[model samples]
Target: MKTFLFRSLFGTFFGAFVAVVTTISIIYFGSIEQLDSEMFLRNSLGSIFCGWFFSVSPLYFEIDSLKLPTQTALHFITVTICYFVLSLGIGWIPFSFPTILLILGLFLIMYSIIWLCFYLYFKNEAKKLNAEI
Candidate 1:
């Protein structure tokens, strides 16, 4: 449906933007130092994509109104676990703490942004649907 597609796309875009901004902020805050621009960009982008994928995966399923909270909690737990695991795995690579934090921070930011976008989109869609009736 249009609503589903809209939410998914919005989520993805919002996630990526947030991840980029967070990465920039981390760099600005001196939390991360980069010697190689290409590697930093690649890791940041990868984190963003991973976050978006996990965050949006749960919403693909349909749920009743009453079950929304439970579904959301499950989604959060799953995403957090996955992100942490992925971050730790990435840390094993030849990167410093700052680099690792920058990557993980971007991932968290993406997750937050996607959730916010989904919330706003769903709220607006619900309102429109109600108005149509």
Candidate 2:
């Protein structure tokens, strides 16, 4: 619980920092115009919550009773829902069916790639530990 809270706080602050930097950089580079203060705060808070949830998302996998696939599915679903909502709230994505589908496809691809990397890395680590044993 303590670890989870710490991770959440760290991610929240980290997300806020990244949000500020990224937003400012875009504005500075002429990629986007400066947002009014209210929109800026809304977007920043959305991103902060995103970071907090994502940081502790891996904890779902820590449940020994659930199989890996179940854990993955749950984590994927929860993250996707939260992120889609956040993106809409932050005005990063529009509220439309086609755009939502496209975004969902992108999320699927991203999640698959990340899951594969973690799976491969952990398998390698297990092999190393077995060899030592």
Candidate 3:
């Protein structure tokens, strides 16, 4: 019970931090220009909530053996690929190599930081729980 509660709290905090960072990056990069203030806030909150959900989803599986680094890498790759494909489909952004690479690079860096923090927080909590045991 204690372990679960600790993990949940840490995960939530990590998710929120990641979301804030992501939101800031998007705004800084002009990605949120199409969104009004209210929409931006809502999207930011939603993305943060989604991040928490993604972070916790693995718990249902074998989370104990999860390789944080590998998982983070794969997550970044998957997101980048998806965004690239989506941009191509929507024609919202010019499908130029430089633009795609820039967007993917920025997102990858931001998300990597977020995931790294979550992984560290979770690892620390697990260590504490093990010590208690």
Could you say which candidate leads in TM-score? 2
Q: Candidate 1: lDDT of 73?
A: 78
The Cα local distance difference test for each model comes to: 0.69, 0.89, 0.64
Whole-model lDDT for model 1 versus the true structure?
0.69
Candidate 1 lDDT, 87-128, residue by residue in tens: 566553335778767767886788789878988999999999
Per-prediction TM-score to the true structure, in the order listed:
0.45, 0.91, 0.47
lDDT of 2 by residue, 1-133 (tens): 9889989999899899988897888798976755778987888888889889899898888899999999999999889888987898778899899999998999899999999999999999999999999
lDDT of 3 by residue, 1-133 (tens): 5555666667677767876776678778966555466755655555455555555544533454657566556566665565455546545357888987787778778877877787789899999999999
Off by over 4 Å in 1: 1-56, 92-110
* Superposed model 3: Cα runs more than 4 Å off: 1-70
- In the predicted model 1, the residue pairs found to clash are none
Q: In lDDT terms, how accurate is model 3?
A: 0.64
Error of 2 at 29 (Å): 0.8
